[model samples]
Target: MERDFYTFCTAMKTLDIGSAEGRGMSPQNYATIRLALAACYGKLSKGRVGSSLELTSEQEEHRERKGRHYCGLKEKGKRKDHERICIPGVAAAALSAVVFARMRHSSLEVLLCGLSLFDVLVLSSTLLIYPAMNACQNEPDPTNSRVCHFFWRSTLIAYPLSLIAQAGSVWTCVAITFDRFIAVFFPIKKRVWATPHTSTYIICGVAFFSVLFKLPAFFEITLNEYGQITPSSLRLDATYQLVYMTYMYLIFILLIPWTVIIVLNGIVIQKVREAYRTHKRLTQRNTRGRRDTDERKMTVMTIVMTGIFVLCNIPPAINNIIESYAPQYRDRYRHRIPLSTLLVCVNSASNILIYCWFNRQFRRSVFRLCSSAAYKRRASEYIRASKEASMSQTLKNKL
Candidate 1:
């Protein structure tokens, strides 16, 4: 009977061990649990294990959810490769081709060109051939499948590029706001502050500084065993999260850029409203009427564009902030990051629509570009028909 009881207890302990491993605990968590269990059994064998061996509620809770570090991140399911590849890659490329093809038209005006440059940067990071091919080659597992597996090494290239593009987009919109502010509030110096040459310098400077600012991220990137590429700290350490989330995301991304844009655009709007209020007093004889109209259209489109940018980008900034400070909330909100990123990509893709909606010149430009091919085809047919007719007339004269 004594031997049989011992055998039964051993079987029960074996089942317990199997259960723990089956629970999908992380290696570290599983090792700690095994160590604790061994210590408990040692005490029992030594005959000193009283009811004190019982685990506390907190210990029990920890054991129950041992493997999970954050809330929503427990399941290492599929990645978002398709959404990431399709939206920014295909959509941004299509929109950029249209904008570039119409470069001779008003669609390539100063403000629109800045936005187009941002879109081009977005396209570059997203449509890289290596990563797309990697995504295609990833095999779908019948079991243990995740959200989607990604090649983290390729992501090292993508992440910094995306950061630069986002920063450049924000700064470009801010520059446009400042240009409009000068044109509306200080008309006498508008030419000095908002000239084509000045716009080029501002754009070039923004691109240069944006790359410089985000350069650190590329150096600190790492690839995990699971083929996921991320920050060296896996976005968990307080210092790393604080630097990127509280400082970079909140201050540089959300607050400063948006604040400057809002204030400058507000002043421009006020000036425009005041000018319209005294329309009768203003001279209709200003010879720069067409130029003024075009400038105003650009201002309106830029203001709307900035507004959309702020709306789309806010969630990602907020998500990073929450993940940095409150870990539990990070788990709760991790699922939202992909959605926020999609919104930002859609913002990049939809600029041509914004341009068309607010600027009649842009609409006209697109119409002209689309119809040009048809116009050429018709002209070719007419020329061929005329040549045939002339040949027939000559043959009749010879006869």
Candidate 2:
């Protein structure tokens, strides 16, 4: 009986009753076939034919639920990879910040310091706050746990903070590129305008505006009394999504910065190449050629950093565009989201390697910094040992 019923349902599903002509049946024939199928289903199920129809609907809903569950599992797995990658990325960014900070104060070094610091903030939030949020979410009774509440609140703040840091990092890259561009194009003007103080002011402005731009993000989500994180009413507004999220974020954060970085870096690279040729011609004048060589190295380092920025950012920018215009295709690209995020982390962490690879001065500064730290440690140990020996000898004399 069950096998016969299964066959009957399959036959009913195969029929194109809604489009009789397309199915090569007259309207009357279609109606008659539909009536016959309804009667058969009614008899087999021993209930209303509507109930039998509802069974198919329920089956469809079940399949959809299963599909959603599978997507969630895949996203969770990807998140684990994000967490693992953030650890080393954050450490590298911190080390880069320290190295840049300790280097001699210059417009380029100052901008590099700002870039590394912002990268540290970006990666730190991903490393620390996100994992805490995830752990809090998994707790059976999160509302009862004070720790969970703390993490939940921290996540709300961290979200906007991370965005601000990321924006700052992007603009700092722009600043670095722009500085190099000025040095290549207008060396005299750069000497006057592109001072370390000017770079500091630029970084401050970038950070301030970045914070102001992302302030709306703080209100996007809220932790309810039930301890469930939910989107706020503002997040549901179409105007907010269209104006703030799609247009504003897309324009200021991704489009403008990318355009500026690409254009300026292109000019800088061309100028550097031209300058390299010029320097080669002037090679016999060792003094001028050596100075030009240093300038070329600095310009090359800026180009490399901005190139990496553009390359790493492509994925996330695509994801952002898709989210704005073609969100229906989001699930198709969902698996790539994790890879995009990892690339951002790599971008943030890879600056130190670039410095080491491209800039001899930066490498020497880092080596000197490490040697100085080691010398300080040894000196402190020696001083402590000498003091201990003197104290022991005084005690022996007193005895």
Candidate 3:
């Protein structure tokens, strides 16, 4: 995550603007904070003014000074070498692809590239390879085997869909992280950095990134059909998905952004507490209330994203790390199984909620978008009636 910022900064330095240090720093810092905020909080503020902010109840958990730290994560599944390959590595790879792909120049090129790859993969797998592989497989004679057909279909669709979803999840996380990074680091010069146009560009970039990211899965995932043992998708021979996913979780998620989220949340939380303390002490800091509120909103978002990443990915990351030994008793706790699944699903689908949580403007915009035409008509009538009353003499004259 930090390297991305540094790379962005380096690119800016090449522009050779006379002394507009702010101009160069604007895009670089904005990009850094783009993912930071995207992962943690919500959408970029489109309004020209400071946005209406809503604080989350989750902010209380982060309010506690000494938050819990992760020791290790555990997984409980019987050791099947092939089963091991299917879930985690594939999941990680798809996410990594989305994260890496968005960094390229433009989303148009990205969409084209991604669409082309998606089509190619769909064509090759669906048309030629699948039918041929099914025909040649162990139960080739069993046309009555509907189970085999369904299984092959799953093998074709499920893994690819998972890869696609991961691409989205990664891009979403990246988008959140970048947004928060800008909020935290560049508080003074906010809009100068994160513009609506830039936000749209970044989001489109994320979509494209997912395409490129998922493209590689075609090479890795293949169907295994062994004598009616219920065929499955497996990563052919790769130890690690050996792509951007590993680099991303290792560098981007776990190491870099998680660290940044933690530290920034801590600082903002502490600052909020300090604002409480300083207000209590000097009694003049409530004047700092609006500024502090913005910071607190940022902190709330930071905390939420941190908690989400920690709760969702940490267990999986730990499970992956510990599975190095592929230890026994990996499946002892039935209690955590549901938690892990829920967290992962929630983590992937969470960006929309985070936006609604932090940005009242986003909420209003969404509400307005979803508002009924009837309601608008009613609102228009009310406004027109009020205007007529205020200009009662004009209404009488017009009548």
Candidate 4:
């Protein structure tokens, strides 16, 4: 489809990811989009050999800001290979841990150990890696600029790793919801139908499906002929490869799952409130008292977790809307601007904090990990051998 000019400009001016937000793009005003992109996205249109080429859209606009990922544009120096590796490592680690946690087939109570480990790994990696990241500066070292160096060799690999991990989470959550629904609506067969064996099977099916769903993304990113890591420039004819993937991400993955989560969570919340109110009424009818704090805790937790899911998803959802319907806005804002890229990065990174705040089970697991027997033993050894540190320095003192 060709571009629409007016809608694009309107979308650009209003979006938070635009010039009005104090985002940086060099040469703040430009006569053309190409000039603005070179100034803002750190690409010099003047490279001698490996110069990055700019694409023009008849409807395209350029702005002076930070997040515009005018891909492949680089300042005249070599790609600063070492500067951006940290994001990928953190991604990989989180993904691996998530897979480990969802490996349960039976005996959930015992398997909860694995789940706890997985959650802790994901939470810790996601949170820690961000602050650890070095600012993306252009390094003269070509070797450091390699994609492998950017993710694994430089800092961590748990961030991109999270794309798959999130798919796993969505699958697991859907499975859990399905499990709850079956028990709630089919109470008579609860013990028989919702047995550990059945839950195990459900988990397995969801895991396989989630993995299959995410395979495309993993494959789409690869090392190109130039020894440079490049994201998929999906062929024009490969509808399923590029455009289809984009829509799938917008509709099935982010949009559909979020919609289901909201509706189901709304129902669950309504039921919980009704159950609580009914309990209070019946108690007054019989004994003149309501349930205590523990019941209230469950109520509060249900609301908290539900809110987390929605809050964690908002950015990417916004991105999808912009990418799908607001292309002209994307164009006019210009690749020279940085607002768009920052929003996308934020979308990618927010999940770390989500589990930390809402998933009580996850937080508790992290606490347990810190206080684990192995940790305690190692901590004691450190204390016994050291003269500068003491009893007050242990994690227990803080957590």
Measured by TM-score, the strongest candidate is 2
TM-score for each candidate, following the candidate numbering: 0.64, 0.74, 0.46, 0.53
Give a tens-digit lDDT track for model 3, residues 1-399. Answer: 433433333333222211123234576665664344222222212421223244355652332111111101111232132223333433433332343244333222232223223322322223222333333332323334554555454555555555554445444544445555555566566556665456556666765766675665555544333222231233433444334445544664357546765565566566556655665566454556666665556556546754675667676666544433343434333224434443554453443456468745445555554465569889999999999887997878899
- Over 4 Å off, model 4: 1-136, 141-160, 182-188, 233-238, 241-243, 282-303, 331-375, 378-399
Rank candidates, TM-score, best first.
2, 1, 4, 3
Give the Å error, residue 312, model 1.
1.4
- Better by lDDT, candidate 4 or 2: 2
Which candidate, 2 or 4, would have the higher TM-score against the true structure?
A: 2
Off by over 4 Å in 3: 1-151, 167-175, 208-214, 224-234, 238-249, 275-295, 324-339, 348-358, 373-399
Tell me, by lDDT, which candidate is best. 2
**RMSD after CA superposition, every candidate:** 12.6, 12.5, 25.2, 12.3
Candidate 1 local lDDT, 343-398, one digit each (tens): 77778877778878877766776777669868999999999999999999999999
- What lDDT score is found at residue 28 in candidate 4? 39
The TM-score obtained by model 3 is 0.46
Error of 1 at 385 (Å): 17
lDDT of each: 0.63, 0.75, 0.45, 0.45
Estimate the lDDT of model 2.
Answer: 0.75
Worst 10 residues of 4 by lDDT: 13-22
